[model samples]
Structures are given as C-alpha cells and as structure tokens.
Target: MTVSLHTRRRQSGVTLLGLLMWAIVLGFGALIVMKVVPTIIEYSTISKAVNKIAAEGLSTVPEIRAAFDRQKDIDYGITSITSRDLDITKENDKVVIRFAYNKEVELFSPVFLLIKYQGTSRTTTR
Candidate 1:
C-alpha cells in the first residue's frame, strides 16, 4: 500500500466577500460608538451637576433649578435637558431633584438613534 498526499489543498483565510461584510459590521459599530460617547459624557456631567446641587444644601426647588441652570451654562456638554425640565419634590423631609430626557442623533438620511437618559441628584436636604 502507498500513501497519497494529493488531496484537495483545502480552503483557508477570509474571502473578499467575508472581509467586506466584516468591514461593514465594524464600521457600523464604530459609528454607533462615535454617536453614543458624547451623549454618555453629557449625561455624566448632568449627573454630577445634580449631585452638586443636592450636596450644596439647596432647600427650595427654585434654588436647586437655578443652580442647575448655572452649571449648564458652564458645561457645554449639557444640552438635552434644562433646569425647567427637572422634577423637584420633597420626600421624607429631603429635597429630591429628578430629570429625564431623550436625545435624537441622526445617523443617516432617515435613520435616527434615540437615547434616553434619566438621573436623580444625590444631595438631599435633611
């Protein structure tokens, strides 16, 4: 009996079509990250602002809203929500400020991405 090594060389590596599909997928992922990062950053800024107001011992709704407005003016990243949009209330003798907003990012002509952000202040007056 003799051994034969002339079998089909076998198919290896990615084809052009496979590479293109991968590229498209990766490209879309990158685009999504690009659009989402700034929004996340802005949300973080807003959260900090809320916490600051809560910590500053602002006892009234107007005062808390005013503080947020000032913070918003200082931070350019904050745009989706405003002081007037915040929901301020008293709970258990503590001041609570809550806010929620939606951001729409236009990816293409008719395609838009919507991001919902909601947060509450950490500072609650006792």
Candidate 2:
C-alpha cells in the first residue's frame, strides 16, 4: 500500500499541536521545579550548617548557641532566615541541640507561590 503525502501532512499537524502542548506543560513543570529545588537546597544548607557545628565537638549550651548564631548566612542563595523554637538540652545523657528554621522562596507568575522550607536538626553531646 502506498502512503499519500496529504495523509502524512495531516499527521504532522496533530504532532505539532501535541508538541506545543507538551512544551507548555514542561515549561511550567520546569518553573515549579526551579522554585522548589532552591528551597530544598536552602533547607539542606541549614542542616549541613547545624551538623558542621555539632561535629566541632562542643558540648556546652553556650558553644552550641554560638555555633548556630555564628552561621547567619551559611547559604548565599537563602532569601529568608527565621529562627524557630530551639531547645538545647541533654537527652540520654547526651547534649541535644534541636532547632527549626524557615526559608522563603520566590518564583514567577501563576499567583507566585511563596514556598517555605522548614527544617529541624538535632545533635547529641559528645
């Protein structure tokens, strides 16, 4: 059977429409991911900073407080920094450092969702 050129062209017309729809869907998806990834990275940065301080082998409340306090801008891309309720106490006979923080992320249109990345970290005394 011989395929007609007209039929082939008709098939391409639908393909182009599908391609355009897909491109738009993917574009928005990329935008959402772009907004999300940075927020996640910021939270991860907070965790790393906390862990780094804990690794320093400081067992005092003042020392732990200093560690977190000193790292004000651990991540350059972090847009918002908020300190949550933190309690540095001893648990299981080990020093426990628990802190939570909130980070905000901004993105382009579609109501411009304001995402918050909240994270908690804890460390036991050495």
Candidate 3:
C-alpha cells in the first residue's frame, strides 16, 4: 500500500567551465592560423619567383638577383629575404637559386614564434 518514489537521473551536458575552456582553446587556434597563413603564402610566392627566374636561363648571378628583386617589387609578399641573401650556384650547367630566411611572429606578450623557410629553384634546360 506504500507509494514508490521515482529516482531522478543526473543531467549530462557541458558545464559553463567546460564551455569556457573550449572557447579559449578554439580562440587560440584561430589566432595562430591567422598569423601563420600570410607567411605561408609569402613563401609560396617566393618559391614561384625563384623557379621562374631559374627557368629563364639567366647565366649571371647579378642577373638572377635582379630578376628576383624585380619579382619581389611586383609581388609585395617577399620581405623575409632579399636579393643579397640568395645563394646562387651552378649545377650541371643549370642555374640553381637557393634561399633561406627566418620569420618571427608575435603571438602574445613575451611570446614569439620563429619560422625558418628555405627553398631551391627547380631549374629547366634551355
């Protein structure tokens, strides 16, 4: 004749603390992507310029450097390295242009990210 009591199940969901933590993590990730994408694009531009100059059959170092400088002027993305920083070499009678540079990006106060970029041109036979 006694009435039975129904047991209540505990609710399961993300708490306020958990949601805040996830928001912080996602915000930090987005910040990093925003900062790093431009540098990657710049690297791609520099690589294309080097490959184009190498395939142009420029025999002299000065000519190659000047070509890169011109390309840099045209494509405003090249700032990490300059014409003087390039390592020009000849291999098997083909012009090889090599470049290496470092980019520093500031994520927050007292914290910095360093990225090293290097590339060698893909030369073509005339």
**Best TM-score goes to which candidate?**
3
Window of ten residues with lowest summed lDDT in model 3: 1-10
Q: After TM-score superposition, what is the CA distance of residue 64 in candidate 1 from its true location, in Å?
A: 0.8
Looking at model 2, the pairs that clash are: 95-125
- For residues 60-122, write the lDDT of model 2, one tens digit per residue: 777777677667555565344533344666667666555555544456543556554444445
Best by lDDT: 3
**Ordering by TM-score:** 3, 1, 2
Residues 1-120, model 3: lDDT tens digits: 655565655689999999999999999999999999999999999999999999889999999999999999999988888999999999888889999999999999889899999999
**Sort by lDDT, top down from the best:** 3, 1, 2
In model 2, the runs with Cα more than 4 Å from the true position are 1-14, 73-79, 82-85, 102-104, 109-125
Query: Candidate 1's residue-wise lDDT over 9-117, tens digit each?
Result: 7779999999999999999999999988999999999999988888888888889889999999998889888899999987888778898999998887799999889
TM-score of each: 0.90, 0.65, 0.92
Residue-level lDDT for 108 in candidate 1: 77
Model 1, stretches more than 4 Å misplaced? 1-6, 123-125
- Regions more than 4 Å wrong, model 3: 1-7
